[model samples]
Every structure is written in C-alpha cells, then in structure tokens.
Target: MSGTAEDATDATTKRQRRGNTRQRIQDVALELFAEQGYEKTSLREIAERLDVTKAALYYHFKTKEDILVGLSQDLQRPIDELIEWAGTQPRTLDTKREILRRYSVALADVAPLFRFMQENQAAVRELSVGESFKDRMIRLIDTIKEPDAALTDQVRCTSALFTMHAGMFALRDVEGDPEEKRQAVLEVAIDLVTQAHAGAQSPGKPPKSS
Candidate 1:
C-alpha cells in the first residue's frame, strides 16, 4: 500500500514538473506577487527571482495575466476532477461523507496555493481566476448536498468543510502536535457529516424525542 502511494506521489510530482512549466512560472510569479504587491512585481523580476531569463519566462507566459491563468488552472484541475468524479458516484450518505474526506485531502495538498489566492484576491479577480474557482466550489457543494435539504443540515455540511480549512489555518496558532490537531479537526468534520446525514433523508424532520 505504501509503495503504491509513494509511486502515485512520485508520478504526480513528475507530472506536475513536466508540461507545467507555465504552471511553475505561475506559482513562482504568484509567490513574488504576494511577497511584493502585484502592481510592483515585474516579469523581469519574476525571472530574476527564479534565476531564469525573461525570454524564457515569456515563452510560457506572455504577461502576468497569462501566469495567473496558468496558476488558476493548476489549482483548479483537481477540483474539476473531483466534481467530475463525484457527479458519477451514488448520492448515498456514505458517498457524501467520502466526498468530504477526499476534498479535505485535496485542499490540504494545495493549501499554500490557496493561501496565495486568498491573499491576492484583487489580482485573482482581475484575471477572472476567482470566477472559475467559485464555479467549481458551487459544483462541489451541490455534490454533497441533497435536493431540498433542510437549511440547518446544509449548514452543518458546509460548516464541516470549512472547519477542515480553518483547522489547517487555525492549528498554526494552537500549541500542540500537528497530527493531533488534524485528527481533532477531522473528528469534528466527521461528526458534522454524521449529523448532516441523519437529517439528509428527511428534509424537514427534526431529531427524534429521546
């Protein structure tokens, strides 16, 4: 199992490196943009920071907008994939829960990229990257939520997903082992999923009297 996982990771790493020079340039460009202001960063500076010639960076990206598009694509492909995969899965509670778990893992893998996006909203908006990302998020939400689900249960499921993200950010401030914090956050998410599922089948049903 470990071998298979490692092989998959290696393959993913290699794939990320190959045919994704544009993506790498975008990643580095976003880093520079975030460090300095987007308005202050130049393509030449990006090249300098990356130790590459301006012409080389220009080969992959004609302009900073091009770089932003590349970065959005890199951050988006997996979520698009997840949305596609989820659309074909059974809409059972188990499937919904699995969707949350898988999403949490995917979010963790791209946390740094997410941070860059959050911090550079104006640039992301300028490049229209935010639109594509938001569209996919809506799709993901639709996948986990049933038609006509009660508002409270929907809130629980939504809160569950956000908690995982918050945990990733918040745990940094809390003093404890990282793994333990993750597990605790995961437990809360799982609990919320369970609560959401309990009411999912009956749109307006309240909890049974004890």
Candidate 2:
C-alpha cells in the first residue's frame, strides 16, 4: 500500500479507538447516573465504575454535568447536520417530509438520554437542556414553516416536532413493540407536517376589503 493510504488507515483506526473510548465513558456515566441519582453520582464514582482513575475520566469529562452535556452534544451533532442539510434544500413538501423522516431516526437513538433528562429534570434544567433542545427545534421549524404561514399552520409544524420528541417517553406505558411505537409516532409526525404544508399551499381566507 502507498504511504498515504497507510496514513489514512492509521488515522481511521485511531479515530475509531477514540470514539469507542468516548462511548464507553458515556455508557458508564449514564449507568451510574441511573443506579444512583445524577446528584449522588460523582466523578470518582464514574471513574471507579469504569475502573479508571479520576484523571483518566477527567481527560474525557471533567464533571458529571460535563459528561451529561457531552452526551447531549454527541446526540445533537447528527440533528445539527440534518438542520444544516435541510436549510440548503428548497422549502418544498418533499424536503419537509424528508426532514421529519431524518429527525425521527435521529431521536430514536437518544431514548435513554431522553429518559435520563425526564427523570432528572432538576439536573437537566441546571444544564440548560431545554434551551439547547429548544434552539434546535426552532431551527428545524424554520426549515419546515413557510414565511407567510398562518398561526395554526405554524402550530402544526411545532406540534409535529414535539410529538416526535415526546414519543420517546410518553409512549413507554403503551404496551407494544418499541419499533412499532416509533413507526406509529413517525407516521403521526409526518402526517402533521404533510397537513401543515398542504394548508400553507392552499388558498386560505382572502383579506377583508373595506
């Protein structure tokens, strides 16, 4: 193999190793957070759980909140990418539908984190979880909502996003397969956006002229 090819392979391997370690830290930290409360879980405890020294744990995450924030940011990256991609596309029904589709898939992987946030609302609030998630939602709404959309149509767009977010935890008590529930939620969310888009394109009430 060429020297450049070898270097590329080596870089890929190193990145994979780093990703694996980071995910391991997140997994161990989340486990500790659940077993005990996030407030009770310490950096030392996380280090002990991972069988690593505090210094090693600190290398990846400095505090419990940092670990939580890191996990949140890791989950946010794909959604951010989706928003960026959607922004470039023409604001059409097809583009909006694809956006909802991708967003649903992205949220599916964060079910555990979503539960953690729900169970530890105080801790999550302190970390500004709502602000970060809300900011992303606003960006996504902008991508779907037309400039002259009616108030009700805008509500539909916002509701569609919230439905997907809430589906992760809200549907937990409903007895059925997990993936099936997710599909059902996705269908509802898509239907919402589809209805909103159709309404926006349709001619509504004309202005009242004197």
Highest TM-score model number? 2
**Model 2 Cα lDDT, one tens digit per residue, 32-67:** 887787899888888888898988888877777778
Show where candidate 1 strays beyond 4 Å: 1-24, 37-39, 207-210
RMSD of each: 7.5, 4.5
Instruction: Estimate the TM-score for candidate 2.
Output: 0.82
* Location of the lowest summed lDDT over 10 successive residues in candidate 1: 201-210
Stretches of model 2 off by over 4 angstroms after superposition: 1-19, 128-130, 206-210
Overall lDDT per candidate, in order of appearance: 0.77, 0.83
Q: 16, model 1: CA deviation in Å?
A: 11
Each model's TM-score, in the order given? 0.77, 0.82
- Backbone clash total for model 2 is 0
